[model samples]
Target: MSDYCGGCRYDPKQRVGDHACPYTAGYWSFLARNETEFSGNHRMRQPMQGLHRLTDLDALVDQEKARGSIAP
Candidate 1:
């Protein structure tokens, strides 16, 4: 609802696809990359569970890897 986000090309609420925010996508990517390590963490339990529910996780991971080092 902020003025700054009104004309932004990226969507903070989205985790994948053309309009996905780099930060949002990166967050999920980071969680996915370290899923095994964070599996045993109680603090990560909810996030991990949410990560598993993303149907586009594989695609998101691929996209993030391809976007490496590029400024979004």
Candidate 2:
């Protein structure tokens, strides 16, 4: 969370739920969609490591497909 987001209703730390931040959801979605390409890249390996830890990956994909809304 940033100082700028202090007044925002959505939580930057959340990945799913009604108040979930779109950026967070999109970021995880992007990583999941590109894990194979990022897996071998040392620069992305650290964040990419989280790809395997995710539970409802399919839901993240749905969120990505929704474009801006993080709902569901």
Candidate 3:
């Protein structure tokens, strides 16, 4: 781990749950929120497919929405 992540509570590899990194959650949230807009783009094909594979996607979306503008 990098020195910057030594004391951080968030996990960069996690996208859900209490210890999820806000940035990671935010990324998936953005993709979920704009799936239609990005669906036709070739570059987005892989990520969009990956989004569909996330079993906890709905939960992640709800969590991020509940978090709103609050900082984690």
Residue 5 alpha-carbon offset, candidate 2, angstroms: 1.2
lDDT of 2 at 5: 80
TM-score attained by model 3: 0.84
Candidate 2: what lDDT?
Answer: 0.77
Off by over 4 Å in 3: 1-4, 69-72
On the 0 to 100 scale, the lDDT of residue 2 in model 3 is 50
Q: What is the per-residue lDDT of model 2 for residues 1-72, given as tens digits with 9 covering 90 to 100? A: 549888889899877777878778888887877788887889997787687788867876786677653434
Give the candidate number with the greatest TM-score.
Answer: 3
lDDT of each: 0.87, 0.77, 0.88
How does model 1 fare in lDDT? 0.87
Compared with the true structure, the alpha-carbon lDDT of candidate 3 equals 0.88
Structure candidate 2, residue pairs in collision = none
Candidates sorted by lDDT, best first:
3, 1, 2
Clashes of each: 0, 0, 0
lDDT of 3 by residue, 1-72 (tens): 556666889997888889998988999988998999999999999999999999989989989988893234
Better of 2 and 3 by lDDT: 3
